[model samples]
Target: MNRILMLLFMCMPVMLWAQRLPVHEKQKELQERMVEVSLSEIQERLSLTEMQISQLRPVYKQYQKKVARLNMQNHKLFNRMNADTLSDEQAKTILREYLDRERKLYALNKQYMDNLLEILSPQQVIKLYQSDSDIKRKIRMEYLRRTGKPKR
Candidate 1:
């Protein structure tokens, strides 16, 4: 009995950590689900040819990855700038680089849209744009709900 009690006590932190593991897994699962759903909605609205779908899928994934990286970098810059340790020149340099990349990405997105349009009718392009916006809104709502807060 004494040994059992000691073992349980020693395992307490492990038990706590294990409990949190499921929650973390759930969060990751939800994020993946959102991305999949968003992509599906896009695909449905676009009604792409097999070849177009094959081409666009990778371009879309690359855009998502780039946006995520930019978001992280921007967040880090914001935190550092707010902390007052970063010099004005450093802040300006970071902001300028971010803006440059953002413009480039925007152009790339436009090019992708043009490529998609070439494969689709104008009506289909409009539908795709509308569906993309709807997906973004849904994802925002889900994020707000997950955080237990309303969007500003």
Candidate 2:
């Protein structure tokens, strides 16, 4: 009983990490696909000019990359906290960093959206916003179907 208990304790973190791997991969793929779809949909619906698309595309891509990086780091920190290896001070520092990145990304996205809106009509912006969620849901469902997992 003592040997079994010791083995279980030793393996617990590995088991937990294994479970998280699939979920993390799924989420990352979903997020990247959604961003791709969003940009295309916005371009199509707004009939964005070539110059506008060129300018806006890089802006979106840059911010998306930044958001993904920060989010991944945050997840790593959170997983450490979950494993009881992260100190309170470290967790607090990571949380603050995450929040700051989130706020900055939000502002950047908003600025890009505003620029696009200047190029697109109000109705087009509304349509783009509405379509975003629907597209993401569809992509997620399709992903789950392919992977044989229930949609989360």
Candidate 3:
């Protein structure tokens, strides 16, 4: 009876959170939230001014959206992959598309770099990139800790 109560107490909040999953199925909102959090951290880390943030906002959002779309498309390509039955020509085509998207991402990132130059010191730009990965890592670590999951 004690063990049962302990288990129930431990799982109650998790169960409630699970029930809210559908309401939170807005992936775009989640993505935006993540970006906002990351941007806030970066802003704090680099001591960005109001004007700097105003300048960076639209460009950053565009970069995020483009990256998200590219990621989704790349994910779809792999989802359709079947190594056992894939023909050489099909493999070639997928590779070509992947490379093309990679080039696009490279150019897009370069554009973002150029845009940042207009509003941030080069050192601040580097810190902004670092803050992004740090925020993501912390979020992932918190999720793993809460779920009692091992690192993948």
Best lDDT among the predictions, by candidate number: 3
Best-fitting candidate, scored by TM-score: 3
Off by over 4 Å in 3: 1-25
How badly does each model clash, as a count of residue pairs? 0, 0, 0
Instruction: Provide TM-scores for the models.
Output: 0.65, 0.60, 0.79
Which residue pairs of candidate 2 clash?
none
Weakest 10 consecutive residues, lDDT, candidate 2? Answer: 77-86
Better of 1 and 3 by TM-score: 3
lDDT of 1: 0.76
TM-score for candidate 3, residues paired by index: 0.79
Tens-digit per-residue lDDT, 10-39, candidate 1: 999999999999998997687667666777
Candidate 2 vs. truth: CA RMSD? 6.5
Tell me the lDDT of model 3 at 104: 93
Would you list the C-alpha lDDT of every candidate in the order shown? 0.76, 0.76, 0.89
lDDT, candidate 2, residue 36? 77
Taking the tens digit of each residue's C-alpha lDDT, what string does model 3 give over 42-102? 7888899999998888888899899989988999998977866889998998989999999
- Choose 2 or 3, whichever is better by lDDT: 3
